[model samples]
Target: MWRDEAATWQVAQRSTAEIWHLLANVDVVHGLYYLLMHVLFTCFGPGTTTLRLPSVLATAVAAACVAVIGRRVAGSWAGLAAGLAFGLLPAVQFHLQEGRSYALVAAGAAISTLFLTTVLQRPARTRHWAAYSTTVLLTGLLHWLSLMILAAHLATLLWTRAGRAVLARWAAAAGCAVAGVLPLIVFSRGQSVQVAWIPPLTWHMLIGPAVLLAIGGTCALPDRPRAGRLSAATVGLPLLAVPQLGLIALSLLQPVFLDRYVLYSMLGLALLIGAAVGAAVRAARPRFPTASRWILPVTLAVAMSALLPQSLATRSPASRVDDVLAIASDIRHLKRPGNAVLFVPPLRRDVKSLTPDAFAGLRDIALAVPPEKSGTLRGVETAPDRIRAALLAEQRVLLVTDASPGARPARGARDRMKTAVLHRYFVPVADEQTRGRRVIVYERRSTPR
Candidate 1:
């Protein structure tokens, strides 16, 4: 949760005057998260809570945005219900605290959407065009898929004859997008997902998780028609969100895709679900005050139930940045003067997964290490060759990794590493929990066979 934020904090500490140049010239390679964090850390100070405070605040604001947008598109009653549903969703809260851009993306997407609809309802004018264009531009910078909202806006604009001029403004928006993204395109050329990963996309990787997310979030659509156009919105939000999931499933064919990367569509999905529920209750009884209250409370309860399980489950246990001190602790206890640590399989340059941040259990442990020994890029056992070479030059390695890829580390990576190549390897000193995941302390095999 904090790795992405901490990495950005590295940049935020620079003098504010130098920040713009830093954002433009430096290749943080983190999508646009570094730049956004610059703004957050500027206000909140460079601590973990401060760095991530924006995401938290953004999502809280987003729930209100959803309700406001819902009231406009659905009805006041449906809007209140939708707002509650969005606020209570554990997924919303989960993203809000992280350093990643997903929560902001969700909020930005919602606000932009509301702007789009309001503009469309009235005659086209330069003022509406400018507002719509600005929202579209901001959305583009927030997340990769936030452009989907722009696409949605365009789709909405096209529904009427008045939409032609507003829709045509996309040419200008496209140019701005290009100019904004050109630097990323140039710097990230070699670093794009295509060059970095090995896995191929699978159905489960794409549609499966998104479908589950959607179902978990908004499966509460009501069966009523008077809930003020909710049935249409309920239908439309899914239609917009589904394509992004397909793109994600496709993206797994490349090197990386964080769930945060695809989080923009969730706002629309959440609001629609709320509307669906309100529409249903309203349908059963057109009268507002009596039935409406029950519908929203029920929807919120269900969304909460769905969100809780996912929140507990997906937070990877081995995320190392969160437990760096623990890993360092295990090392300290088992350490001899000469013992050294190795990042197994060597970390990929600028790769989040390639570093100690990957291990949730060892997160604080790694963070607590002295600056010199703390951030070294050594590989844990099953250590990659390059990183291994770095460590072999030293004597010991407090190796770690959950290389199993969604599977826990098997029985003993220390033993396996000893067998695989480091014949002189021994599980002489260490802790082993699930496979290679837990820290292992080792003294080279006492004697070469």
Candidate 2:
């Protein structure tokens, strides 16, 4: 498990009351997902499989929804190709088995889109509108960022010129969903400090979305899409382009442009690819009747073969920045009896919180309150003076921190004090660095009599 998944594990282990209390202070955006994981952990008991199974299933559901939408807008062959394509995309593969809300949010986006396609194709009914509203509400509850999909859907409506009735009904349903999640949106804003670590947007950050749009545009060209038509290009182009462009616009103000936030956009790209394939097969059928039948299957096989290496790499521990599980094992091995531990930046405390068994015999010198009791992700720490005094009293202190390249100098007063006192009074006995984590053992020097 990586740090983010480790967070899910630690939070999900908390009691319902504790989880609710924790949300009151931070991570309210993930409150619903954390609660859902809480129930799963309660029943299944905590393990890697229990933590990640829901995401795997949710991703499968997203792929199935893409296939259904493709079939409706294009054809059976397009549906098969699109569904297969959804599973093969690198971003989708990364989060397919992650223990995070984003996968489930992607599934919800696909389901809501499927419903919208149904309503637009058939006569818009109250039941269909209600289903769309309810799905949108649930998806927003999972992560409000997904509510951006409504913008993509709106662009689809406008592109198709679906008439005033469809537009007004869509407005009503979307209005209801937005109102339902409005409180969460407002409350989560107060806790926006959680995202303060996200760096300012840069030119390099724009490259990924640019490449995606270029590919989607390439696929869309073959469709020769026209307005007022319910086709893949009309649906897929907006779904692919709108959210990404909207996110870029928003990032100019607040810098919240993580790709996982819009992973559902890949559904649009897959649809366009499927539509292009369907178009090719149709154009070639009369000229090469027997060979045309094999185009999609052959294309799919080639895609799978090309992506096999990346798919395997995504499943490996090396793909993530750091492994909490690995670091915990290192702590267990490096620790001696009665050693005191300190985590720089305090957030590194997650390793201990997630795998307390590894830290059972060690003392957390700076922690004033445990996370569950404190109602925070990272527990409250003592003041710098107290932490320094505690460091002075200890014979051996283990400093757990980010290894080089990932490491940043201590910025907080308490963290700086720990570093200063350790250097002044102690000598390094042992240092172990592995997989983006470092543990240094410092033994106090003898004072001359």
Candidate 3:
């Protein structure tokens, strides 16, 4: 959670030119989002709440857009229900508190889809088409993968038998979005190593999509003869199915099936569920009118109750695999002044950057240059010889590693050297383990073995 968010904050803290340079090299996919956060940090100053506020606001906007979409496709009751469902979604709630671009990307997806609907409904409206294209372009800029939603939209348009002119316009807008994002896509491809941590598709990876399909299928059972020209099934089903199935299929060739990547698809599920509930309530009103009034409330209450534990848990630090703030706090409490610190594997430099205040008292022995000076996230580490020399020079060393108990030893020469020197020259004094993080302290022995 904060691990990725902290990286984004660090990027935003750099100068505009530096951020642009970093984006071109490493995170070009989120270039627009970094620029937006950079402007926000400049105006508001930086803090945890300040960093996450934009995402919260974006989530609210996404909920509103979901409501609008529901209203256009279903009715007022469905719109309200959909909005509430969107807000209550666990994934949506989790991202709302994060400092990353996912929430904004979700919002952009919803807004762009809303515009796409308008374009389809009024095929002759040039302004609507322009707005749709512009929104698509902007959403693609925010997150290149978000353009995957266009495939779902394409399927929707084709299934609905949209006019040839409408289909052509939709294709043109999608093409414009792809053209606009091509540079980012190309640059990001070079940085593909960034997401190498994503594992190949597994049965576990299908759980989320399966659960969503189950819920959507259950909701789809109820008949809504008057659902509207763009029925909930037409829009919601594809939005839920295409991106997920497409990602899963692509993951067979290359690993890239992360649920957060398609978090916006939940809006489609919510819309369909909302439409079903509203339709059922309306259909029941003619019979047992008194009980029909309670149907919507009862359904909503049950859904929220089922999600309550997860929603509450999501707000806690423990919900995340690694909490950088907690890790930094523990390190601060355990560390002594002037102690040398080594981040095993070297990529964990963002942990220190995230909690600068907590790590300010410790010295990073391997760092030859600061991140700002070197224009790199982890900064430039000293040579292996210098690192070993610096470790030998220290009386006390703090080793922060991402390794677990059964994990393989460090592969890099510098990492291996650090471990070898520590184990060979020093004795372990303290050890602590948190999710995905390990901190150990070693003291110089009176006589080296």
How do all models score by TM-score?
A: 0.72, 0.98, 0.93
Candidate 3 residue-wise lDDT, 74-158, digit = tens: 7777788888988898888988899988898888888988887776665468777777888878888888878889998988887
| Cand. 1 Cα-lDDT | 0.53
Tell me the deviation in Å of residue 77 in model 2: 1.1
Error of 3 at 73 (Å): 1.5
In order, the Cα lDDT scores of the candidates are 0.53, 0.91, 0.82
- Residue 426 in model 2: shift from native, Å? 1.6
Error of 2 at 312 (Å): 1.3
- C-alpha displacement of 402 in model 2, angstroms? 1.0
lDDT of 1 by residue, 363-400 (tens): 21212232222333221333335433444454555555
Query: Considering every candidate listed, which one attains the maximal lDDT?
Result: 2
TM-score of candidate 3 on Cα atoms, chains taken together: 0.93
| Model 3 lDDT-worst window of ten | 220-229
Clashing pairs in 2: none
lDDT of 3 at 196: 87
Minimal lDDT window, size 10, model 1: 363-372
For model 1, state the Cα shift of residue 278 in Å.
2.6
Q: Total backbone clashes of model 2? A: 0
